[model samples]
Target chain A: MIEALKQRLSEHFQLTNLTIKNAGLAFLWVEKHELEMLLRQLRDFEGYTHLSFIIASDHIEKNQFKLTYMLHNYDTKHDLGVHVDISRVNASMHSIHPLWAQAWTYQRELKEMYGIDFPESPRVDEDFCLEGWDDMPPMRRDFDTVKYCEEHFDDRDGRATEENRQTMKVNIYPERGE
Target chain B: MNLTHDFSPTPEVDLASGKYVKIWHGPQHPGITGNMSLELTLCGDEIVNCKTHVGYLHRGFEKLMERRTYIQNFPLVCRIAVPEPTFNEYLYSAGIEDLAGIEVPELAKWLRCLNLELMRLGSFLMWLGGASGAFGMSTVYQWTVTHRDYILDLFEEMTGARIYHMYISPGGVRAPLPDGFKDRCLMVMKKVEKLLYEVETTVLNNAVFKKRAIGLGVISSDMVDAYGVTGPNQRAAGYARDTRKDSPYLVYEQLDFDVITATGSDAFDRTIVRYQEMHQCVSLIRQMLDRMPTDGAFHTPTPNVLHWKIPAGETYVKAECTRGEYGYYIETDGSEYVRRVHIRGPSYTHAIAVMEKLVIGANIADVAGLMVSLHTYPPEIER
Candidate 1:
């Protein structure tokens, strides 16, 4: 399995650092350029038909967000975990949706939740997060959850007020039906 | 050969004729189960068409899990499959354990099976509650819910939380079974058997239930595959697929129990599949208790998960839930949190794709019954 993935990935793109990880279910590496070609090979060649899930995390101190591709093999009962890091500065990626149909909602969700840009995705209009809003993506490691709670969260049943009175107070906060 | 597929929009009927009636089963219908709306177009005693609407109970749990820690998501995973929360915990823990190279002790594995089977029994009882109510058998619904409480109380005693017991850690269980847990198991199994008799006479044998369920929402083996329906619904259709038997995880392989199935492939068969499976769960739990060793480490010693960073890896763990095979695909990048978690809930294939396509022009009256009979859980769908 390791040799197969290594050869398959190496055939498409030059791999820098490849390691068999997560129970040897996948060949993990930091692919420099031909990301699309490698993903295409994963989809068409290896029959890793399912795009299991994609997760993006911010390495705030490092100024980079790690984007991981969790891939599933249809024929084999093994999962392929792929990791790639895109600079937090750009927050963009060439969409992998052309290879997997299910990646649409997940990528769109990434845009909403993490404010990452999928530059090549044509159908990026769907709103996955805050409507009529202005704020950093909530999923970003930099996004302060406590501050967001302080700003938008209501002290329903006087709970937040009583709890936060020991910490912070909201002077004039408009509330609605919870 | 009665495959429904006329996706024309339904129009409201005029009430002035006195023959046409409009009923809003919705965002608040007991039969609808979750917060879902099914606008039924009825022409008095018969349904013309039905339109299903979602978005009432959308919690964006998948989105929420991304925000919380791996351990914190344990409590939240329960909310995904409300009726069978432990199934979610089991899958998630198993996935992490598989990835983290954690080997739980033998006794702990048996206890896992005990908790799993108990959860299945509890969930099946809840399904009986909903399925019975869907068919207008109120007594069965009431009796089943009241009786299932004992199982939930047992869960509460074991894990503090009655409904969402975040007890199944990735390493193993939160703790070993409480003292006299084996006696408690025996007590529950005996009680469940007696209650099973009461249920058989009062509900399962009820003529009205039999008539309504035997023919309504009938499906076939081909239909099961086409619709991707599994669990009791598929077993009721005579399929040989079951994670317990086929891909036995945890301590299921050693446990002695039959994969209860039926050939009718109708509402009655599906209900029976669940009913008998509850008994099988009892039998399985009893068998597990007998075979279970008295002592072993309940949890594998792993790096304190609070401070633990998963080695960059991925693992897909699959388990048999009350419904069917529950698959969890997890990816971690040597972090305190998971990279991403995608749940391949069998219900997604059954509820939305299958239910939507199958219930197109069926009797609107049978729509709610059909949904419950299908064992559709909306969180699994929406997640």
Candidate 2:
């Protein structure tokens, strides 16, 4: 099934970075310029109709964010993940909500969490999953959760803090000195 | 893509001669399921527009999981979906197992199936109570909740907890089944089946329920595809899409059962589909108990929970959960901690996008009932 999909996809579009990572699973690094065309062909021609999900992973080391669009083709019973890397400085991508209405929620979430801009998407600017949030995007790699919790919320009197966990780990495993 | 749904936002129209009354439906109301609010624009008794507001129960599970190790996240994952927690555990474990190349024992697979079917039965019982109770049928609600407690008793015996049973671990189940567990499970199934019959006769067959629910909240077939609605809600609309049958996972491939569906495509039909689905779960559990091996290892050994590291890879595992297609997208960076974990719950779509679209033309009184029919778990949507 993976080979058949690869063949079908290669026949019409370029397969520059296609890799079959696992059986019944394939990964393709889609270029930012060809995202719209690739998604349209996948939905229209390749029969991958179900837009399972769209998620963004922060890759701070690589200085880029990886956005994976997970899709499943009911006809072929195959799962595919289309990965696209966008710059962290000015994250922007075209909206595919026109292709699938469910994409509205995903794009809205991405906009809120990663500060990614989707040009021309309807209602993508509206707040989702967060209300009155004005800090850094909480899902980003740089958002320090421990510090945020410490500053914004009160701490219990008897609970362990970050320093306490580190001290306990060092005490338990003395051979691996910190 | 279908390309039939209007993706554009609803235009600002002058209703009530530019005097439309806007009201908040929930956040604290008996009609609501959880901590979520719906902004409803009402002109007289008709609803003009509805906007769903979530995040009341959001804990940022995705962000939190990235900071914790694989095992530390196990107990936290189940909290994503409070009503049906095992499905989250199953999907998370399945994804980690796939990424780490952990081979599960056959006995473990069968045990997982048994636990999964039990979770489905328990969740549907809760749904039965809520769906009928939305229409003021408190008798059905009380009976189903009382029976659901029996299933919770079975869970407590197995996992030492009732709501969040952290029994489903990475390589397999956390513990072996206790002695006489099968007999107790079978006895409970018999009781649940009898109670289900009474529920059908009293609530489902009543003429008043039919009058209120049969034609209300009808999900058109085209809308199911356009909005990505799944689980019993989509099946109630005559769509034969199910992850268990389509993409067979766990021991579901070896089980024998039919995907229950209905043609009415409305609240009543969706309720009936869930009703029949509970019966199907009973039969599946019976088959699993009869065929499961009597003596074998229930779990595969793994590394220490605090320091285990998975290779660098990404995998997406999905399960046909009680509510819908529950998917977990996992990415590891060859470290003791996870790089990212994205949870795609069906309620994220059904509760927000689809509910907003369906509630526009519905009557004000039917809004809560319609939301109930969709089986939207608020925590799943926010998390």
Candidate 3:
């Protein structure tokens, strides 16, 4: 079922790196400019009406952020994930709020967590979850969470930290050691 | 049926003119299911604009999962949604299994299904209590919560914990069903079935519940896809889009049950849909108990935990959570730790965008009932 859809979609649009994970799931890469039109076609014409989720994975080594828009076709019970790679420097992508009202929330979250810009999304600038989060976008691969915790918070006195549980257990009970 | 109120422009309220008052609805209120607030702009007891506020319970489980190994993340995922933790445990394990190419055993499959069905029954009972309590029926709250405790007792026997049962591990389940557990489970099912009847008589048939819930928070069928609504919320809106029926996972394909739905698309309709699903849960449990394979291996062995490295791949695994379509999108990097893990809870949209739109033009008193009727958990949204 997904093979025929991919064949029909590749005929018109430029689809690259198609990965058929299973019979009911597939992911394909498309240009950022082609995402909106492709999603609109899928939602309206291809029976992929439900926008399951939109998530971003930061590929810092490649200086790119991969944004996946998971679309579900209720009629066929298949999931088609549309992946779009945008540059990591001043990342921005075309917003799909016009296609799905819930896209704005995902866009807003991507903006706050990964510092990706979605221009003209409703309330995109406002805080979604992290209020008064003045530091770096916490989700970026560059942000070191452990360092931030050590710098901002105080550790409790007499707190024991163990790096390895097996070694600590052996040290505590040498008679019962294996 | 007229949904013009949802699309109509919001009337601006000027606080300087003293015509409207702004209030925070929750974070520490009994009406809210968890620790989250709604910033409401009200004009004489009618809410004009509603903006949902979360992050009070945001522990950044997604970011935390990046540093933890595959086995370490098993316990952490259950904390994402307090009410329904088995969905997280199952989906997390299922996503890992999908990417790692690990097929679970037959007996494990039926056990996982039984665990999930029990979780659904327990979570829905809690929600039923909250929904009734929001509507000023405290008696139903007491009755349902006590019965919910009966379900919790079953969880305690099965998984050794009441709330966060990290029993559904990656390769397979943690253990087999205990001895003599079948008859004990059937006993609790009988008690819960009796409780549902009492609830139906006292809460569903009550005048106050119908008066407050029938026409409140109507979600048009058109909004189900656009706003990403699912589970009972979308089912109540006249669409029978259930993950269990559409894409059957685990033992759902073997189970015989119909997708429950309602046509009104209102609070009362959603309650009826879920209430019927509880009876469906009872039947599903009975079917699994009768059909499950006896005396077989319950778990599949995996690689060593500390040095395990999954081959690089990505997969999104979802399940029919009591709330809606709960999922986990996992991307592996062929290393000891995961690259990216995004937990998609149904409340992420139902609480924010849909709640913001539904609460507009609603009375102040019905806001809690409206929110509860949507059946959202706040930790899942912020996570």
Candidate 4:
């Protein structure tokens, strides 16, 4: 299947760069990165019609975020999981929604969740969450969810106690710890 | 090049003239069975182009699963596919059990099958309603909804919650066979089977339904394979791809039933296939209740869900949901929290790829009709 897919990728797609890095029976992850020229060539390309998912993973350990486009060429039974690694500090990439309309939502979702900006995408400004007063984008590598929970969410450690509740009263209440 | 759909490119390439108005149908539309939208570019009553936009319903379930412990996600997993929640909890517990090397007792497996099949019937009844409503048959909607509420009541009696019954846990069920629960479930299921037959007379065999659904969303066998369509949608296209039949996790292998398949791969075929499968579910439920095993554990032993370390490994569990193959691909890094939980559902492919291919060249009037005919649960898609 890998050989067939690799041959089909060369025959069907004029890629600026492509490589097969991982292979396993459970799953195979083929890394492919394309420049602007190959991006236009891929538009007219057939067999790569179905798009499974587009995800931007915040690899905190690697200190870089990876944006992956999992495209399925149903015609050839070939799955090309294209990934582009970018620095966490400037997590931005060229959007592919111009080639496929379905990327519009997934790109918008990646931006909303990870604070990654899409430079050349359409409709990326759609609001998924963080309606106003923005803090760190939630899916960022440095978002610190536990800290965010402590600050934004209710830290109900011994929260249901009567004295703690009484001291927590808004008006005419004395400070106390339970 | 891959247009096995057999529709030739328009001789005059209407070219999706910019005059066509693009209408975003949902993410919220009453006509839509769930919170998903189709970007429909329509030229009068004809559809020139169509695209599906989901992810509005994303609850960050995979991300949220990373935060919560396995047990806490039971209540949350119920929200994955609200119409059918038991399967989500069932698969989660099953996956965890498989990882921990905990084998569910034979009785528990059969009981799980009983619950899954009954839920299938209940959920399919809901689908029958929405599928018919797509063609302006409001009565089927009312009929199926009224019938399904009784099943929910049975669920409430068996477990505590009406909708989100987090009854099935990692270690057997949350509670053992409630007194007379089996009889109550059987009675409701028998009544449901009767209502299902009435649905057959009024909706399934109804001529208007045929006109609305038949050949409306004709997905080819090749399209089904290419797009990874599974469950009823795949079966509807004459592919016998039910996980319950193929993998037979739980008690499905023990139970005796034939996999239902439809010939046309069209909207009508999908509806009829689900209708027939509901009958089979009724039979399977009866078989399970008839051979009631009142003696073994319903769940495996589980530790404190929070701070409970799960054994490091990956487990993938799939079941024949009312829609299609409902699966969860989970990865555990030996932590209490999941490393990654890829929630795969039937709607992921059905509402996205298959619908995208089917909607184009179909009449604009038939767009919503085609969607409801597919019977995709939107929350599952977002998950």
Candidate 5:
């Protein structure tokens, strides 16, 4: 079923890197510009109407972020993921809020967490999760959460230093040798 | 598909006009489902605009999972949804298993299904209590909560934890059924069945529940796909889309059941759909216990937990949670830690976009009832 859809999709759109994870799931990459049309076609013609989610993965070394839009077809019980990569330097993508009412929330969250821009999305600039967050987007691969926690949070007097559980157990029970 | 939804611009409301009053509905109120607030703009007891406010309980689980290994994430995923954690554990483990190409044992499959069904019953019980409590029927709340405690007792004996049962781990489950667990579970089921009957008489058949719930927060059929509604919310709208039936995972294909649905798509219909599903859960649990193998290995050995690295791949595994389609999207980088993990809880859409739209033109008194009908857990939304 996915192969037939891929065949139909590749006929018109510039499709690349088709990866079938299983019989019921598949993922394919498309140009950022072709995403809106492709998604409309998928929803209207191919019956992949339910938008499951939109998620971003930061590939710091590649200087790009992979955004996956997961769509589900209830009739076929198949999940087709549309992947689009945008440069991490000025990450922006076309908003699909016009297609799905819930897309704006996902776009808003992506904007807040990954610093990705979804132009004209409703409340895209508003804080979706974090309030008064002055640091870099926390979900980005570059964000060092451990360092931030250590810097912002104070350690208790007796628990200033952290120890590995295995090593601590060995130190507390020296009679039981490994 | 036709793009018929009119994305009409929301009319600006002037708070200075003195005709309107703005109020915060949640974050501390018992009427709210969890620690989430709704900013409502009302005009004489009628809501004109509603905006959902979250992040009160955000633990940043997605970011935290990136620093933890595959095995370490098993226990952490359960915290995403407090009411029903087995779906999280199952989906997280299933996503890992899918990417790592590990086939689970048959005994573990039955056990996972049993755990999920039981979790669904317990979660529905809690929602039943909350739904009734929201409508001023506190008696049903006490009855359902006590029955839910009985289910928790079953969980305590089986998984050694009442709330967060990290029994379903990567590769397979952690243990098998305990001795005489079937009889005790059946006894609890019988008691729950009796409790549900009493609820049907005192709550579902009550005059107040029908008056307040019927024709309230009605979601049209077209909105189901547009807003990404699923489970009972979609089922109540007359769309028989169930993750268990649509894409059967584990032992669901072998289980005999029908997709329960209704046409009203209101708070009352959703409650009825869920109420019927609770009975289905009882049946599924009984079937699983009767057919599961008595002696077999439940756990499948995997690579060392301290240093488990999965090949680079991405997969989205979802299951029919009590609320809706709960899923986990995992991306591995052939490292000890995950590259990216996204927990997709149904509440993310239901509590935010859907609730924001449905609350418009609704009475302030019905806001809590409408929210409870959707059965959202705020922790999952911010996780």
Candidate 6:
């Protein structure tokens, strides 16, 4: 199945990298410029009809955001992950909502959560998974969730702090000496 | 059926202007199953457009899982899907085990299957009540919920809690089966199976239910492929796309079962599809009880969860959740904390994309019924 996918993708574009992560799971790192064409072939010609999900992971150390478009085929029950690296400074990608209607919801979520831009998505400008507030996209790696929680919400009064909690863990389940 | 009707509210212009009145249909009403709203634009009794609004139940679970240790994530993921909580736990545990290179024991595999099947039965019972009640059959709700509590009693005995069972964990299950647990579970399941006949007569065979659900919210196989509608919704459309059958997870490959499908592809067909699945769950549990080894290792040993660390890797584990496919894409950075955890719940597509398309041109009275038939749990969508 992996060989078949590789042969099929090679027909459309130059296959730069194809890594088989696990049995029935494979990943292809495509150029950010060729993502739309790659996904179009995967959906149309490669029998990858189901757009399972779209998720972005912020790799701040490399100054890149990894966007994965996960697709599944109904006949073979195989999964393929198409990974694209976008510049963290200006994260923008073409929307595949025209290919999969479900992409509208996922693209809207990515736009709101990671502040990524999908230029042509329907309802991409509307509020998604969050409400009216002016703040940084919370899912980014540098969003400082603990600090935001402390400022916005009140903590429980009787809970132990981090240091005390570590001590309590040792006291409760002491390690056994062999 | 009359598609247009007179409203008591005064109209500002004649019918030629193409003006429609908008109404908020949810966020508080019993017609909605969860904390979600649908903004419906209605011309008389026919709906012209609908926009779904969620995020009322968003708890930022994805971020919270990243902050907490892998062990602490067990309970949090279960809360993502309220009705059938064990599927979330199962996927998270399986994903972490895959990343950390932990092999689940054979006895634990059967135990986990038992737990998942029981959860499916419980969720279908709740759906039976909600689907019937949507069409003004309140008695079926009373009957089905009462029988569902028996399953909850079994859950309370096996795991300490009824709704959220933090029993399934990374290495294996949290604890072994209690003494005589199988017998007690079988007893409850038998009683539930007997009562299913009554449910069939009251809900599936009821004339009113048939009239209300026969052709409502009809979904085609083409629509299922395009929008990714799954589980009972797709099965009712005559496509046997079950994850258990397609990608055999756990001991499901070893066990014998059948995929239930119907031909109607309408609201009534979906109801009947789930109504028939209860029998499969019962027989599957019976097979588990007979085939499982009595005195075998139930859980694998692991490092203390508080200090456990997974190696740097990423894996996706999926299972047949009650609603549809439940998947977890877990990544670890070789640290005590998880790097990323993205949940691809079935409701994400069922609630937003499929519901948006199905709601347009539907009668206002059948809108709630259509939503109920899709079985979209809202928290999974917003989370």
Best by DockQ: 5
Docking class of 6: acceptable
TM-score of each: 0.73, 0.96, 0.96, 0.75, 0.97, 0.94
Top TM-score hit: 5
What is the per-residue lDDT of model 6 for residues B1-383, given as tens digits with 9 covering 90 to 100?
A: 11111212233434456667788989987778788999888898988777899899999999888888877787789999888899999999999888888999988888899999999999988988888888888788887898789889888888888999998988778777789898998998888888889888777888987888998888866777667778989999998999999989899998888899998988999988888888899999899988887777878898877778899977777888878888998878999989988999888999887887788778999988999999988998877
DockQ of 6: 0.46
Q: For model 1, which pairs clash? A: A22-B313
The parts of candidate 4 lying over 4 Å away from their true place are A1-59, A62-137, A145-178, B1-19
Better of 4 and 6 by TM-score: 6
**Least accurate stretch of 10 residues (summed lDDT) in model 6 chain B?**
B1-10
Better of 2 and 5 by TM-score: 5
Residue-level lDDT tens digits of model 4 in B35-114: 87888877777777776766667676777887777766877888888889999988888777867777677767776777
Candidate 1, residues B149-247: lDDT per residue as tens digits? 988888888788788888888788887778888898789788888888888887789998787777777775545533445678778988756767765
User: Which 10-residue span in candidate 3 chain A carries the lowest summed lDDT?
Assistant: A168-177
Query: What is the RMSD of candidate 1?
Result: 7.7
Give the distance in Å from residue A66's predicted Cα in candidate 2 to where it truly belongs. Answer: 1.0
Off by over 4 Å in 6: A154-168, A176-178, B1-19
lDDT of 6 at A3: 87
TM-score, predicted candidate 5 vs. hidden true structure: 0.97
DockQ winner between candidates 1 and 5: 5
> What is candidate 5's CAPRI-style docking category based on DockQ?
medium
Candidate 3 per-residue C-alpha lDDT over A92-152 given as tens digits, one digit per residue, 9 for 90 to 100: 9998888898898999999999999999677789897899989999999999998999999
lDDT of each: 0.71, 0.86, 0.90, 0.70, 0.91, 0.85
Model 6, position B176: C-alpha lDDT score: 74
Worst ten in a row by lDDT for model 3 chain B:
B1-10
Clashing pairs in 6: none
The TM-score, computed over Cα atoms with residue i paired to residue i, of candidate 6 is 0.94
Model 4, C-alpha of A2: deviation from truth (Å): 15
Which residue window of length 10 is worst by lDDT in model 4 chain B?
B1-10
